[model samples]
Target: MPEPHLLAADTDRAAVVTRLDESLADGRLTLAEYEDRSARAHAARTYGELADLTADLPLPARREPARREPARSPVASALHGGAWHGAWGHDLRAAWTGWVTTAVIVVGIWLVTVLGSGDLQYPWPVWVIGPWGVVLLARTIGERRSQDTDRQQLPA
Candidate 1:
């Protein structure tokens, strides 16, 4: 069942080896069969010879192409200090702003209720603000530790 016509003049060693491996992996070849075919494939002289090695094997679905990292411009890379561009700074600032907004809103509501009642009400604002304050504190500490780690990792 080998397509003898598909075999041509130019064939490389890698192609032959690949086909033999495929045959082995596809279970078309037992270990002994693989070894024998692999030897023959290595000794193969032309494209036809290599094609014969895998002619009986079924082709598997193609795999996704490998990922490659995005290329960075030299000037932009230098300007951003390799790893300092976004790391934690923007996030920390936003977190602080969020905490301030929450605190102001809770206190404003609590103060209105207290003054309107003509007596100091229970400090109920603490209930709303305490949990948010704890969350922001933890986040700030985590960011500081992470930045310290990143700074340590940088080359001398």
Candidate 2:
């Protein structure tokens, strides 16, 4: 048996219908599509029938629970973990890469201005360009940190 909160039948069916109607009225759903699906959902007598009405809608793919048994070998476990782990690791690495690349460019410009035979002066091109590089690096890092914080706050 499922928990009462998890059962659709235990919910306010009228409220669900009202939400669907609002979606249609707000242009989130086309009138023709809404009417057709709403009619199907209304006429449904069983859980399966109601599910079928919205089966064609795109939904976020669910992650399958890991198996506890040894039906799968150790290699399968390693491979499964590696796929998603690598993707998240790459994302984190890219953020650092951006910061490092920006810093290198800034340093290169500063060195050229100081060591090279050029009139290095305040309010010059290098002064303006150098700080912009650091600003970009800070912005990228801050944005990524904020996004990570937001993701952490969301319910899994």
Candidate 3:
């Protein structure tokens, strides 16, 4: 690397200003000193002049890149229709089978209750089935939208 005194003033001035900004915040530089140093930094023509402004302050730490979720695969979608058909480790087919089996059990109880009483009663199964159906509908819509979004953005 070239000596600090040999570097161009304007090229490294931002780095010095940033350090000066920190010094001001840390009470190392008063408002007057900060103002004077900031002006000198911008007007500096040599790297030596710029370096003089914040020689006492440490350099800012380097930042790490952000982490993101793994990208969804098209092959996974084509094979599965949707990746999550079941909660936990179960597939969609199993989820549907479980739901259907539950519905049958609920209806069977309602039927036996009505028959035993020998009186007409409201179809109370609607309360259970109605909400279950709505949840399925929402899941289906969300999956469709996700698939569409995947289609729109081609992987680089």
How big is the positional error of residue 45 in model 1, measured in Å on the Cα after superposition? 80
Estimate every model's Cα lDDT from 0 to 1: 0.68, 0.53, 0.70
| TM-score (C-alpha, index-matched) for candidate 1 | 0.42
Q: What's model 1's overall lDDT?
A: 0.68
* TM-scores of all candidate predictions against the true structure: 0.42, 0.26, 0.38
Worst 10 residues of 2 by lDDT: 82-91
Cα RMSDs, all models: 25.0, 20.1, 24.3
Report the number of the highest-lDDT candidate.
Answer: 3
Flag the better candidate by TM-score, 1 or 3.
1
Q: Which residue pairs clash in candidate 2?
A: none
Q: After superposition, how far is residue 89 of candidate 2 from its true place, in Å?
A: 47
lDDT of 1 by residue, 18-127 (tens): 76665555556666676688788777766677777776776656879856547667677568665333444546654565566678888999989988999988998798
Off by over 4 Å in 1: 1-89
lDDT of 3 by residue, 1-156 (tens): 146667564558887787886666656776668779989988887777887777776766676975654556767755776565323222333344445657888999999999999997999998987787677767767666776778889786
Query: Which residue window of length 10 is worst by lDDT in model 3?
Result: 85-94
Top candidate (TM-score): 1
